[model samples]
Target chain A: MSASVALSVEGLAFSYGGKKALDDVNFKIRSGECTLLLGPNGAGKSTLFSLITRLYDTRDGRIELCGFDVKQQTRKALANLGIVFQQTTLDMDLTVLQNLRYHAALHGMGGKFANQRIQEELERLRLYERRNEKVRQLNGGHKRRVEIARALLHKPSLLLLDEPTVGLDMPSRQAIVEYVHQLASSKQLAVLWASHLIDEVYPDDHVIVLHKGQVKANGTVDEVLKATHTGQIKDAFYSLTQGEHA
Target chain B: MNIIHFWRALWGIVGRELWRFVTQRERFISALVRPLVWLFVFAAGFRAALGLAIMPPYETYILYEVYITPGLCGMIQLFNGMQSSLSMVYDREMGSMRILLVCPLPRWFLLLSKLLAGTGVSVLQVYVFLGIAWFYDIQAPWQGYLWLLPALVLSGLMLGALGLLLSSFIKQLENFAGVMNFVIFPMFFMSTALYPLWKLKESSALLHNLAQYNPFSQAVELLRFALYAQFNQSAFIYVFVAFIAFMAVAVIGYNPSKGMMIKKAGV
Candidate 1:
């Protein structure tokens, strides 16, 4: 409910028929914080993201974005959300600028303002030079950058990324990790980055480890480490999701 | 939402579809070729075998090609509708649909915008087909050409909504070919696209009734009358009502909470 709280999920649960995909999940992401959602395969990471983004409606509990209930105030809540889905959503034939402009327009931005925002995001992602290139022509890393740029076009309050670095090379992955962390602080953005990659976690980042549709641990890096009694995040994550395969 | 936002989003969606249509030369060619082939080849072959009576829209006996011109226009819209459905399925599978759905606007508005965009593209294709038919010596009254625009828009929206409904039911791209075979062919052939209701009665009473009641038949009749500078009131009402019904169901089908997205989320 606080102004800084960009995303809050309370007693959230979702199921596929009888099988629960998410169970009583609770978390709040404040502005200027990067929350790493650590979950193994089938650990409800995508389901949580889907619910938060309103891709799948919440039936069992509540979700709010920027103090607006996603269900009751969907338009306002969603207006504050920018998502980079796990898969590449860009049109392969469209140029990077075209794709970003489309996103801007969808968010109800137009003319000089929309163009200016597109340029700013593209430039910040170091993709301004290749703005005219077709998305298909870009390397995997560059395409991901464009997706990132597109997500940021509307200046959303909370950015949801669902395993965005899965297929990228190490350097690209590293660059994105750094860029997102810096972006969170610089822009006062709230970011919920879902990943199974423990190495992507930063020392200052908040950590929420999920397993089997439940939150196993949620705290700051130090708090989670202290609670789990582990020396490192890799060990902490393995211990939290002990039975699941990485 | 503000009107400006709604307008921009509509423009963005329509512009994207137009860009895609313009860039894809093969799609444009195929859209025209299908109707043209029916006009040039099928109508040519059937002209001697079938004769037309003095229908309301036709004051005198008309050639097979002339009789079938409006039907071919309906065919273009129908095929274009299904093509839009195919692309919707493709976009969903490729993950692009999520981007469109996540826009802050109402879901119904988003779906309607998409419907309108597809209808716009189909209208463009219909005009192109009509232009080519004009060259083939099939011409409508100048005012009728203008009148056909609204009819095409209505018919296109109805067919496109039907396509959108089918896309929601279609779970995978691999299943779409079967749906096209099951849906497009029957709707086209069972209707008056190739023959009149009276002609169908000569073949079978059941076919006559079915063709008489088919929504596609009404759409064709609407186009046929409009192309001749006359209005078919019953056909207009039928097509308009069908468009509303189809659009309602398509909107519901795409609803995230109650519809296909739930099934999709099961993954």
Candidate 2:
């Protein structure tokens, strides 16, 4: 509940039937800082995201979003966070503007203010020209942008992106990377950017390496890299998680 | 969930559902065309073959066409339930199901909102279809319009909940044609949609009891009663029980922790 921490997780656990998916995971993301969840496929990152976002109920451990318990004070907690799912959440049939307008209305913003917010968000995302375009017409990166715009409509203090840059071209990936960095800076927002793409993490940003449902390493990139004793992250990440020791 | 935010979230889900229906014109046709064919071609051919008896809520002699209106309303609901389930299968395949699963609203509210919206579209189609029936001399008492709203709401909820339940288990679209053959046709034919259950019993005791227990029969009877400037309490009870049961199952069937959402989340 400290002012510096936007999200805090302790000992999270989840299982599918009898098999464990996420086990004893722990991490904290702070204001103006972005935390990258680094793990390969089947490393339980998505399961972790589902638990943090309250998509899946958890029996073990605790998650606090912006000082509110996710399970107990769920509405207040959820209200303070905006999430971008790894999948495309936009309605393919809806125009960009219509989608954001509908999102604002769901938060019960008055129609006039919702309209104003819609205009502002679309403009901020550089998507005004495509406001009338249905999601079906947009490319993968553009659709990702729409999801980002949709997430920000309610003005959340903490943003959770589950692989926001997946499938994007290099420029689009860089654009998203830059945008999340800037957003966290400008708003003092805390971000959890979950992905296996090692390139997205900068040395100074907090990094948490999850392997087999546990936090194997967590600190600023340099600290974790130095602990793994590999000069480069890609090498350190592979050395840390691969060859049966992870 | 906050009450107002919850309600607003429901509206957003409904709006998105309606948008999906609009963009998929093929789905719209699939919902309406089969029912219209049954009303116009199939019902017209059987109007004489299906004898009219002491139908409840009907005090005097009436045409077979007039007697079938309530059953047809139930038919619209039945078709909508199955149709919505089919689209849910599509939603699962396309991955947007995750989006809905992760919404801030309570899960039950989200599911109910979908039922209400799909039912709204079904009821709207029913009115247009009813207008067609009217031009052909199949219309009911003009007084019936007064009680139509509640009737439509109940019928829509019943069928839509049933659809939600079905959608949660159905693993793929290819499995749906089997539902149409085994589930929809049997439910429609056994219910009093085209014949009175008393008469259907004359053929088989088991079928008779099944028809009486058939929730669709209750839905039809309720609509039939309302359309005749009356309300049937027994019929309402039937619908109430069916709605609660189906919705309970629907809620459990799609829950993210243990229900079908986890399996579907194979993503």
Candidate 3:
């Protein structure tokens, strides 16, 4: 509810036919911080990302980006948002630069402005030399970097990455995690990073642990550990998600 | 967004589509080859069997190739429309369509941009087919080519919108082949793309009525009339209305509604 809050979701609900995917989910992501949406598979993490990104309708409750309601003021709300989906979205046939330029155009950037922004993003990601290469030629790690750069090309205040490191080596995953952490502070961006990997959670970062379509825990990593009476994030996540089943 | 920006975005999408079209050389060749085979192979076999009266657009006997040329143009648009839809299914599966949909622009505008881009490619293919046909002695007035431009675009939009509407209903790439078998082939075989309504009526009144109601037939008739420097008011109205209806349905299907199967994202 603070002025600096970049994204806010309250009582969000969604269902697929007879099955509920999300129920009464609530959280807020503030600027200059990275919040991990830590959940196992089928925990409604992707569904929540879908709702926040306006990929699905906010049927029951509200999601706002930079104070703009995603449903009503959709254009304005989406203008402040950037997203890197779980699947690789870059056009493999196009060069790395072409992929970024295409994304910029989708956000209404053109000509000199689009070019300069693409150049800046490429350099920032250290993929400038590979800009002319087809995206398929780039390795898994570089492809993710290009995607992150594409998402940032529009200068969105809020970034939503849905299980972005799902298919990568440990080193690549660690590098991406560290890179986005740097981006959060350096760019003053509010990032909602969804992942099932327990290792991705850092003690200082905010975490929202979802289980079976419900918000099981929402607090900093240390607070989550404290509330669950656990010594580590992995154990904390386990107790919160699997305690009833166990 | 400003008009310039809108145009730029449209250009970007269209440019990517064009780039893909060029890279996929077989797509361009197949797009042309389907209609050419109909024009040369199929039409040639039927040339001796089917005779033509002096229609209003023709002052003399016309070759079967010339008669079906416009229909073949319509065929190109039809196939291209479905081709684009197939790609839409693939894009959805591959997650690129999600990127296009999440843009801050109006959904209608984005879909229209996609329609226009696909139509642009279809138009290019149509002209290439026409250019090759001209060499085969299928002649029209020089002005006919000029008139064909707008006609191709209008008909292309109608077919493309239909493709978009179909894509919205198709849940996966595998389901799209069913669309081709049920939707594409039926629409093509039942339409005036291959024969005139009178010919269909001579065969069966019910078949004639069905062909008359088929929007693909209306689109072909519009192209036929336009290519000969004539206007068919009914055909134009049919296609225009079909465009609106198809586009509306497509937009509705793509909307994140509560009960729609399309509401499921990222899968």
Give the best candidate by DockQ: 1
* TM-score of the first chain alone, every candidate: 0.98, 0.94, 0.96
**If both were scored by lDDT, which would come out higher, candidate 1 or candidate 3?**
1
Best candidate, TM-score-wise? Answer: 1
Worst 10-residue lDDT window for candidate 3 chain A reads: A237-246
What's the TM-score, to 2 decimals, of chain B in model 3? 0.95
Model 2 Cα lDDT, one tens digit per residue, B89-182:
8876776665565556667877888888898888877787777788888767788866876888998899889889989888888989988998
Per-candidate clashes, comma-separated: 0, 0, 0
* Reproduced native contacts, each prediction: 0.75, 0.42, 0.67
Model 1 over residues A91-205: C-alpha lDDT tens digits? 9989998998888889999889998998899889888999999999999999999999999999999999989999999999999999999999999999999987889999999
Runs off by more than 4 Å, candidate 3:
A243-246, B258-267
For model 3, residues B172-196, the per-residue Cα lDDT tens digits are 8998879889998999999987778
Question: Candidate 2 — what's its lDDT?
Answer: 0.81
The DockQ value obtained for model 2 is 0.42
Candidate 2 chain B, poorest ten consecutive residues by summed lDDT:
B95-104
- What is the alpha-carbon lDDT for the whole of candidate 1? 0.91
Order of quality (DockQ) = 1, 3, 2
